[model samples]
Target: MASSPLGRPTRGTTGTNRLRRNDRWIAASAAFRRADDPLVVDLGYGASGVTAFELTARLRRTRADAEVRGLEIDPVRVATADAQLAEVRAGRTPFPRDLRVSFARGGFEVPLADGRRPAVIRAMNVLRQYDEEDVAAAWRTMATRLAPDGLLVEGTCDEIGRVASWVDVRPDGSPLRFTISLRLAGLEHPSIVAERLPKALIHRNVPGERIHALLTDLDREWDRAASLSTFGATQRFLATVSALREQGWPVLGGRTRWRLGELTLPWEAVAPVAGP
Candidate 1:
């Protein structure tokens, strides 16, 4: 059952391109690649709509016909985002569709204007305020609203978007992959991500939990690969992730993403947190 819960309104502390890492990942993803109808939703996109506008611009590079919509529960926020996107409708934003990007007032149920399903729902920081126990049903509620090949990239990141971790969820409401993206240079430990983990894993970082063990192992491998830092943080991260895979960890994504300070593991590696 969908929790009879509407997430509390956030502080709306937003800025331009704050969700760039996740946007880039989605734009180049397998789902977006095969999508016939490329509509994206920036759910609860805070006080400013700049991130929604930025998502449209980023996704268009791969699929020029792509469109992005920013959804918010606040009617006032919807009004503001709509007005900002109106510039594109006026042919002033150098964007494709006249109203390619629009805003609507809706909660997690996604009250679309004309009954539309989105290809991707990038709900960044939306779940941070909810109780940890509410994360799964919330995921199920949003995933049901996706197009057949849709994706739900739900996760959290810091204010400037430097460090982020998200789970790529499918229509079945099951997570396919877990990605931890960080600015490699000064990245002390991969486990630091536990602090910024989505509402799902944030509380699961304590001892005896799968997430804790995962981070502990990552920190160990990072230390084991420390000597490789002279080649650059990217190289060190690549080596660290490679080591994890060799040690029988279920790390899934490969070198291309590792070089970007991202490590993707199968959902099972972190699934115990959500287990009874």
Candidate 2:
């Protein structure tokens, strides 16, 4: 709508509760809790708008006034989401009749006619199609459209939503942290998430890359903590994460999050290798 969509159309693959992990993370983030304005953008919410609806529902747990605007570059996809909204309005669906959500056609520009910047923007699985080098520019465009103190969450996840990782960027487009989340049940190794790294770090998973080392270490530590498995995968993961921090990985959060099979570290810990 704004000259161009800023990126190509996606396969629009989406499923019920596919983004539940992402939504829960947002609900718990300080950005959502302390938003001067509780407006959020779900950029590139694919073939279905269910994720957007789900996001608003989850965020409202922390901020009752939370609102989510689902932006899609494809007009047809936008129309589909809008149609679903209509169904809810007409009482044909179980979605809350007063749900705070909307669908629109736009891209990295985030064409919200109201001209108000959102407090949080979630761009999940939106940048995986672009060349690795193109990620920064896209991040800059979206980050510029944020409210002061706003947050941009960019990342990817497995098809079934079991494994996920994301980078948290500030309004100035500077990345702050990297987070990896897993379901932990039957999880063979943390490295399995190597395939779902954010676009900027996906190709950087080569032998000498920081991300590669991080995952490699995690796998080894996970094995070392296998003895804790008698307690549960949850205990094993917690021990593995503790080993990472003790080894100076700059791990963030604590057992509360680690017990959930989530690990967060400063961006510097896994940023791509500089230069070609």
Q: Assess each prediction's global lDDT (C-alpha) against the native.
A: 0.82, 0.90
Give lDDT: candidate 1, residue 3: 28
| Cα lDDT for residue 183, candidate 1 | 81
Q: Candidate 1: which pairs clash?
A: none
Tens digits of per-residue lDDT, candidate 1, 125-163, equal 999988877888889888998998899999999888888
Q: Show the colliding residue pairs in model 2.
A: none
- In Å, residue 132's CA in model 2 sits off its true spot by 0.5
- For lDDT, the strongest prediction is 2
Candidate 2: segments with Cα more than 4 A from true spot: 1-3
- Prediction 1 global C-alpha lDDT: 0.82
Candidate RMSDs in order: 3.0, 1.3
